[model samples]
Target: MLPTLDARLTAAAELVLPGKPVADIGCDHGKLTAVLAASGKYPRVIGADLRPGPLAKAEQTLEHAGCKDRVELRLGDGLSVLSAGEVGTIVLAGVSAQTTWEIIEQAPWVSQVGGPRLVMVPATRHSELRRWLWEHGFALAADRPVQAAGRWYAVMAAEYTGEVRIPTFTECLFGRTAEWPEGAGYAAWQKAKLPRFRLGVPDGTELAEEIDKLLDGSPSQTR
Candidate 1:
């Protein structure tokens, strides 16, 4: 029997288009790569990792699943190993927003003409990543908050549209949940965390005000 995908990986898989080539960065055990290969939705799947040990593990997992032929395991950091237009979509999950932002900033080719789509799930600070995407010529195509392993995660799918638009404070924090109903839970989750976030920051009053307005059923006023 094949290994099952967790809710998070399932969300990532659903974002990929059929027949498109995909690169799975930080593919720890190659589970996502193997699943993508088996689905026959992607023509090819590249499983990349910075360490050889994880690449070896990915190889083992792929071989065990009899999907070694469909997935090409590569050992490299970030997107350095991939060439321009090598794949039409890239997945970066289980990483911090800061790290994901750095990877995207370094790999400018991913935003060039006919660049690959970006499918990311930041383990923390999702607002930073969303704001960065808007400023970097990418458009948010889809965003969903999925409940996995008793935790909430934000799944963001974006395309390089070469159009720049600054995201408002509300969109940065809650995402465009008003447009994508799937993110309502995520918005509420973020709303609940605002108190804790306010405790640590010196200028937490702004966050408190936002939360207060939200609780009072008023639209968030941009800061």
Candidate 2:
């Protein structure tokens, strides 16, 4: 049996395409990379971060898990540690949207691959991050929230599509597609979130409009 992953790590795992290489940028504990490599979810994984402490921890974890050969722990800024075509999918999690966007901005090759994927979990300023990604030619593939520690957190998966398609404000805020088609499972998944949004949400404004659009599928309010 494998060690359990937290909600954010699980969300990142779901975004990674099977059979492809993956890199976890800012991979703090290296837990996510170790789990993915040990599970055979990907053929290769590079766990990278700017600091060495976390990288060392990740290396130890991967070694203990007997997946050291499959997982590489690198010390550098995002994407700088990996060469061209090193990994098909990249995850930038456990960081602020500002830092994450800066890394994405620096890595131009992100737009070169056929179907390269990016999984992001921004701790703050996510609206700015989404808008920046859309402006930079990424397509919003999947956007949803996961409950963790009595709080709901959003996850976004995007790909380099080389086109500028602005997501509606609602899509940008909550997510871009209500046609989620993941069926009752997803709706049930989202429904569980309604109460929290109702309870803690601030005065009626852009966020509320966007949330409404996410629920009702209205482009006018969302756009």
Candidate 3:
């Protein structure tokens, strides 16, 4: 039996297109990569991590799962080990939005012709990541939340479409998360953050009210 992946990892995998090579960046244990390979959904899954310790752990997990042949383990900085169009899908989870940006920025090949799809789960700064994607010629395809590890995480899928689009204020704040159950929880969670948000940022009070109303059965206020 394949090792079960945590909710966040599972959500990330669901965003990837099947039968394509996948690169799981910062793949801590390779569990998700292994699962992706074992499912026969992808022809190859690359588990890339900067640290040797975690990559080694992933190696053991893949070996035990008997997917070592299908999953390639690499130790290098984000996306540095990958070439243009090497993998049509890439997964970035358990990292900050800034880190995700840094990884992608350092590797411009991802946005080139036939570039890979980005499936990311930022632990924080979902709004920042979303805004970055819009400004960088990538279009947001999916934005949903997953309840995992005693918290909620936003998982997103984007493609390098070469057309830039701006998201509304609410969409940046909470993403399309209001579209589902975990999104409701995500809305509540962001609403709770309003009280502690430092001044000089966007108006938390106004944003909070909007979120509250949205959660109270109002239509999605997206643009």
TM per prediction = 0.90, 0.78, 0.88
Predicted structure 2, TM vs. truth: 0.78
lDDT of 3 at 34: 87
Global Cα RMSD, each model: 2.8, 4.9, 2.9
Q: For candidate 3, what is the lDDT?
A: 0.83
Report the Cα lDDT for residue 184, model 2.
31
- Candidate 2 or 1, higher lDDT: 1
lDDT of 2 by residue, 1-223 (tens): 3457878679778888888899988888778888889878788888998999988888877877788888878899788997767788899888888898888878777776475688998877566788888888887787756656665556788888889876755445545434443323434455555557755667587666556655665233232
Which residue pairs come into collision in candidate 2?
A: 171-175
Q: TM-score of predicted model 3?
A: 0.88
> Considering every candidate listed, which one attains the maximal TM-score?
1
Q: How would the candidate models be sorted by lDDT, starting from the highest?
A: 3, 1, 2
Minimum summed lDDT over a 10-residue window in model 3 is located at 194-203
Question: Which scores greater on lDDT, model 1 or model 3?
Answer: 3
In the range 1-223, model 3's lDDT, one tens digit per residue, is 4789888888888999987889999999888888998989888889999999999999899889998888888999999989887888999988999999999999978876568999999988888898899888987778878888788788999889988877765678777787767776777776676445533445457655665555466436352
Over 4 Å off in model 3, which ranges?
202-220
lDDT, candidate 1, 1-223, per-residue tens: 3568888889898988678799999999888888998888888899999999989988988888888998888888999979988898999999999999899989888887568888898998888898998898988777777889888888889888899988765668866544555566666777787666666655557656665566667445231
lDDT of each: 0.82, 0.74, 0.83
> Which residue pairs overlap in candidate 3's backbone?
none
